[model samples]
Target: MNDVATPHDSTALVTGANKGIGKETARQLADAGLIVHVGSRDPERGRRAVEEIGGRARLLVLDVTDPESIAAAAHQVGDLDILVNNAGIMAEDAPAPESDLDAFRRTYETNVFGVVAVTNAFLPALRRSPRPRIVNISSGTGSLAWSTDPERAFAFSRGAGAAYRSSKTALNALTVYYAQALESAGFKVNALAPGLRRTDLNERATSADGDPAEAAAGAVRLALLPDDAPTGGFFSWDGTTVPW
Candidate 1:
């Protein structure tokens, strides 16, 4: 493993950081003294978030779905210590049989392919860091193990978000594959389940028990892990292992 560094000297890039869990993750990371790049597809929003952060946070206008944008972002950052893939979309009521192919395509575009593009783009920069960590924001809904459990609360709604759920499952797989491939290079890659938050992605539907800030904790924790920390793991906000 590479030598671990203090947060004050490390740099991090968080996609979809303009709002919601991504924003909170960026905020927390910056608070810990990391130079954070707040990436958003919308330039104005990105700038706004940077302004709000008002410290080491900078605006990175990035659309993970856009190859050109990903390339430009890669070019902009000379070095990176941490990468958080938090951008994703949801299409309501996209169950099987009657599922919309367009919805599935759109969901996969951002949740799956977009991650691959962004990760590949930033690979060089990430490698330059003494200790590189990659955190992919995932969801419990994506857990095939949990979803199949009749006792799980989310299992009842499992049939509903086929597109979104399947996309996250694929994302989890990507995280594992990347972790395995990069292990010898001293790169730590893990998937974090932020849980459901009150965000536009879910039309602001939130659980009273859920806190957006709390949800972001998992990502932030994984981002600053020690060199010997476990990679290729799936974790929840409380640091518990999440079933695959």
Candidate 2:
């Protein structure tokens, strides 16, 4: 509702921001002059991330799998103009049939249910803002059509395990449902694929070495979208629409 842009006053909360793309997202948002709250399950790591950003970026304790932590985080952050649900886990093992069910459950705990918990917990604060935005950090593998399409490059690859991809698919669905609900409420809710980047989630030694800063750019763009920006859509780092 408010068209005024106040860099110093705009508040943002980035979940799982202690490292990787989340950390980079926090750093970039801080540099862009927004007050960023770096959320991490580990206080020490969160503090370290904040120090690395070196500005008004504060550290907040948050574990998406823990409902209490999510509530506590919402209470701590208070009102927010942007909420970036960047926290997620990947399946380290192989695909389904060979994948560990426990690992799959754990992945869902953070990737699926965690997103629901965190978003619901923060909806009140988000509603208070004139221009509220929610960006769910998703992956390209999550797109069933894209991954299954014979013409798609990813389809030819078999490295994409099942749990991680399925969880992201569920996340994309969640994004759409939330976006529809918030349509009349005046908020933008969408999911974004940051592209493959080298991060601990992929086992530090195994991931592709891409700049996390570059990956976070898409998230920052979605988070800072104007009130009129489209919601309930999937997008890649370059702002191109992604298949559901």
Candidate 3:
């Protein structure tokens, strides 16, 4: 009795898909009929996630910070239509003027460098797809416009997490560059802020308002964007454009 025609023979790769927002995104995409590659640094964890997802879900052992791992993953999962750069980390203890330089370096290594590495490694596969899409899981903390405005939501709390915030800002910049470069090829590269949800990344600081699926809404929408969808934009969970 299943009647919905699945969206082509497209495949999606979601990095850090073993848990949290990435996992939710994978589930949504798989439900939408896209073959989803759940990328995790740990193969066991990736396998577990794939098993939990049940259908059209495969494991991809990928450590974004490791060039060899990225290259190997690229080779294994060819012909990708979507790439979700959701792997990121923050030095929870480090903040502001006293933030540890080593911590900042580590954060950048994963958040910034890792993204660029994964994106480049997957470029060939992405280029081959009819409607290539890249979604970077960004945050409001990275919004330069909001962080600087005293009346804005995150302004008061912007003093902390320099490493994480700046890394996402750099990620936003990367999105713009990639979008511009891939425009002629019909690729859509955009950044999305999943909002502060209850997740391991945030140490579950907040209560689960509902389900983790709530946070993945924006990313899911961006991942399955239409041909005419705008590229190089930052959007919130409800689809409102975020200022740079």
Each candidate structure's TM-score, on Cα atoms with residue i matched to residue i, is 0.95, 0.94, 0.94
lDDT of 3 by residue, 1-244 (tens): 1122236788999999999889999998998888999999999998899999989999999999999999899999868999999999986644578788888989999999999999999999999988888999998889999899999866777478788999999999999999999999999899998887777665543565546687676787888888878889999877888999
Residue runs of model 1 more than 4 Å from their true location after superposition? 1-5, 204-209
Error of 2 at 215 (Å): 1.1
Clashing residue pairs found in predicted model 1:
none
RMSD of 3: 3.1
lDDT, candidates in the order shown: 0.89, 0.88, 0.87
Q: Is candidate 2 or candidate 3 better by lDDT?
A: 2
User: Candidate 1 lDDT, tens digit per residue, 1-244?
Assistant: 2333468689999999999899999999999898999999999999998888878999999999999999998999998999999999997556767799999999999999999999999999998888899999999989999998999976787488889889999999999999999999999999988777787776444434577789887788899888778999999887889999
Candidate 3 lDDT trough over 10 residues, lowest sum: 1-10
Q: What is the lDDT of residue 46 in candidate 1?
A: 90
Candidate 1 vs candidate 2, lDDT winner: 1
* Stretches > 4 Å off in candidate 3: 1-6, 204-210
Compare the candidates by lDDT and give the number of the best one.
1
Q: Over the full model, what C-alpha lDDT does candidate 3 score relative to the true structure?
A: 0.87
Identify the candidate with maximal TM-score. 1
lDDT of 2 by residue, 129-199 (tens): 98888999999889988998999876876745788888999999999999999989888898998887878
